[model samples]
Target: MKITVDLDPKLVWQIQSEAARRDLTPGAVLRERLVSSRNTLELENRIRSRVMSGMCDADIAADLRLVVGTIAAVRRRLGLRPNRRKPGWAA
Candidate 1:
């Protein structure tokens, strides 16, 4: 399949430069970016679901292979209270 659309020359140059730096074609760079954005959305959805399930940020982050701070930020943005530390838990 082939499609064509006009992009600003600067944007095209940036994409081409990125492709060269990554040793990939321009189209592959674009596809990688699209897939990365979709994956990020999916990750956020999983984070929201886990937070709603009363999972602590540390647990969610561990399960999702993400940093705990990222999970904490998302939890805060969703207007959820921080999880209480478990009894005898030490950090």
Candidate 2:
């Protein structure tokens, strides 16, 4: 459910600056920080495990119908770990 929000001008500027620094759009950064920054949920955990299991973020997000940034945020919270097969590409 997408909602329209009226953010303070300063906050918007800060978000834009952070997005530029992170090489992402403002919306992507906001989603990562606000939505995905919440405690890891069931779906998020499953996505993290799949990511840790060597599935790419693009693939996982596509399969789960979620944004890549959300997947990335969840992955960050889960910390880096070796996949079951321990592929170098996963590192």
- The local distance difference test score of each candidate is 0.82, 0.75
lDDT of 2 by residue, 10-54 (tens): 989999999999899999988887865574577777886787668
User: Candidate 1 deviates by what RMSD?
Assistant: 3.9
Model 1 per-residue lDDT at 74: 77
User: How far off is model 2, as Cα RMSD?
Assistant: 9.8
- Which number leads on TM-score? 1
The 10-residue segment of model 1 with minimum total lDDT is 82-91
The clash count of every prediction, one per candidate, is: 0, 0
lDDT of 1 by residue, 1-91 (tens): 9989798999889999999998999999888888998997887789888777667788788788889999888777778887765654333
